[model samples]
Target: MRRNDHVILGQERSMSRCTRVWAKFFAFGALCAPLFPVPPAAAQTPAQGLTAAQMREDLAVLGQTWARKDRSFTPEGRERFELALRRTTTQVEGMHPHDFALEVARLAALSGNGHSAAHLPAMPSLPVRLWWFDDGLFVVSARADHAGLVGAKIERIGRASPEEALQRVSQFIPGNDAHRKVESTPFLTNPRALERAGISPGAETVALTVRDRSGTRRQVELHADAEPARGHTWEVLLPEAMDAPGRWVHVLDALQVRPAAFRSETDLEYEWLSSEPRVLYLRSNRIYSVDEVRLDLKLFEMTMKELVDSAPQAVIVDLRYNMGGNYLNTILFAQALPELVAAGGKVLVLTGPVTFSAALVTAAMLEMHGDERVLFMGEVMGDEPRFWAEGDLVQLPHSGIEVRYSDYFHDWGNPCREAACLWATRIFGPKRPISLAPDVRVPTTFADYARGADAVLTAALALALDADVGCAAQRVRGAQAARLATPAGRACVAR
Candidate 1:
């Protein structure tokens, strides 16, 4: 399809939490937490019937089994976690299952590992789709008008707040990642609670008290809507508001090839909207090796070359759904911008927590190339420069689990310094002691994506056209006849 702008949700998981099986008690812990209060380590106890000794044995088994296969964790880290487990049992004796699971999830998060997280039960597809990030939870797709909820924190769903419901549901579902406890819970963390609060399948409407951007408290009655047949999560067709002044473009890089070493299901897939005269929007869905190098600069170069050939007044490069592949492609994409290189124009880039690896590299590269002509839209770029490796998935014995980490770190030492090697990072890059920042940060919401509320894209197009008009006037005002001869200017005139 020739979509001028496209939204691509590339499902690229370096590690699959779904396939791997973990401790049942951990699952119980994840699901049971809603039933009782999560006690502090010192005050906690195992289920009422299970002795402290049994809890210790169960924890030992889980830790020992997990440790046998977990190469990411240090021996010291494992030992510390084992000690934490032993200490936790002293508190687990009299606790409810839900309470115990919460503590376990807490312990897993404490492991300070990205791979460690709670797993929630499979949700019966609700009309809501949420994109979870460290900063906050975003409603990417929803059936509710949710206009009042565009940016409001869904503190409570029905009766229980998001946190309370998560604590309750996590008792049964055990997560695989150990880094963020909050990240592990699924969208249906508190279905029962949400139902009680009047957000159930049969409910025609939901009542919500929301806090607006102005910090004013108000109650909004939202009508239930149907999910869009196509696209991810919630989908809403947008209306043209030509006067609005914000633009955000998600430039997804769909170039690059799979390295010969680790070619999986997805390799060298390029599907995007290109060659539009008014605006050139390119999205890179994956990062693959262009040549021998890890960063494929040529693919981005080609994308820009295409845009320059088409000579669109504005271009939006969306890398929001791009999962790390070739790091250099982004840099190449920045260097290839027609405005910066040809028209002396500008590009607007859309980003978010979903922006990772080569995507981050691309964002960083734009800054380095003196491309002030570029603007960033969406939530903050993933602060982590994760070292990505396409290698063999090694399964550890006993645990029946597989783990993947990169063999090297890809760092672009410029405006945004990245890791030289792969270690423990906020996202996945080096331990740079600090994180990178975005030029202009915009939050992503369900309404924005649904309504095609691409503030960045709109802004980029406006700025591009505005700049183009001014530049065209300067260069070709009295020389209309001369401008007509130029193919690049001809399309703008035709439009």
Candidate 2:
């Protein structure tokens, strides 16, 4: 969830240094705020319900702000926004604050920009934390009071099935289908969001139909927690760290071992994996620097230097949990990574649903510059290669809800063409169309996670250790052939 200011392109203006700093400060504060005992400012909305006039004022502000600040806003998008705004304006009179906020979000989602959305402060959330595993939606973690719900597969939310509820909530999530799916998992546990989506009635407690570990189906009523729902953090997905003292209970609390991928909490970490070929495992959780500027770049360079000195046969660059940060700081590393691989060695890049924005950019950069020796493994990236990004947050005066706007466009799929692309190319160099589909797709199943198994890492390790070129080449060729069989992959191949 780390964010950074993107380079301004063409006639597009940049925020003032003070404004950027404050934006980051506030965003970090909001992201890291604890989930209980809402702050005084955020608690104001519940005390005094937002009036229709206030909602109208906020809608106007949202429109004006996006018009002035969002460069990606086109004539077609403006027309859609106006229509949606007029329609929503008619229903605001008797709508609840949560519904109003979602309507505002719907307006932003119309832009089709993943970075754009209205963020409600201190929004009420259910006690249980949900995650979408390969099997289905399941409760991964929960408050101590609802600990029994952990590991239970969610069958239904209220009257709607889990998939139906997710589809309903996805309308308000900005981004491609992949990004929407990633964002919608958390909203499944938000009573206000579910109510706004019509997946659940506006009630004090919502009914959840779940199948427990023993395959027992039952309904459980969960009330909203006292604290507001916070933004998604990848750390919350780590099984080993799920149990927090006496407050929360994790599904894998009984497991004593932790996966190698979940061992590091740092932004950049690298170590040698004990294998036949001597694999170097590098995990980048975020593209951020804590104490020093360009620290990620420095660490990346140092890691590469070590790879050169030791001449490891294989390198794994893990970006599964890296949401994004400043791509400017890591683009050079991406550009240089391909050539650094040892002559007979292979480099496998690990990506997942959280590998997005700046992180996605970096991965694409690597793929575009890399040769056959470089490969990708893990799930599809969070967002599409071509998308809009790079804008600051705007807070509404009346409701204080923050709306993120996007002003810049990025197309990592193709070479520079437009003004924005040209401007970026001037700094980042020529780009090439990139197919983000992994050469080897590895999904994390609930069973793998329940036992602290790192399936993706294990696959990478096996591939790296296999000295037989026939097996490795066959696997890569088969994966590529399967990808070419799909419509999207065929298009990528044609490109």
The numbered model that scores best in lDDT is 2
> How accurate locally is residue 13 in candidate 1, as Cα lDDT from 0 to 100?
25
Model 2 Cα lDDT, one tens digit per residue, 1-495? 010111111122334454355445435323432211111133245225778888888888887775568666678988988888888877789777777777877888887777776665566788887777777888887887888888999999998998899889888887777778787866787788888788889745789999998999999999987675543635557644444444577777876545656554556666555323456677776666544334333444454346555666787888888878766556657766667766787889999887888778778777877757778899999888777766677888887777777666677777656775424544564355558788999998988787776777768866786634333333323232233255543332232
lDDT of 1 by residue, 1-495 (tens): 133222222332222232123222123322321110111112122234654455455456546654444444456766776777668867766654434444455455443433333321122233434444344444333333343344444555555555565554443322222212323233332333244323443334545454544567666554443322222211111211224333111111111321111112222322222223344455554555423322232343334334444555455666665545544234334555634333555566667654554566666566555345666765565434332222222322322222222233344442224343432222322223223455566554434343323444444444555544333332222121233346554454444
Per-model TM values vs. the true structure: 0.49, 0.82
Best by TM-score: 2
C-alpha lDDT of all candidate models, in order: 0.40, 0.68
TM-score, model 1 to reference: 0.49
Error of 2 at 200 (Å): 1.0
Give the C-alpha lDDT of model 2.
0.68
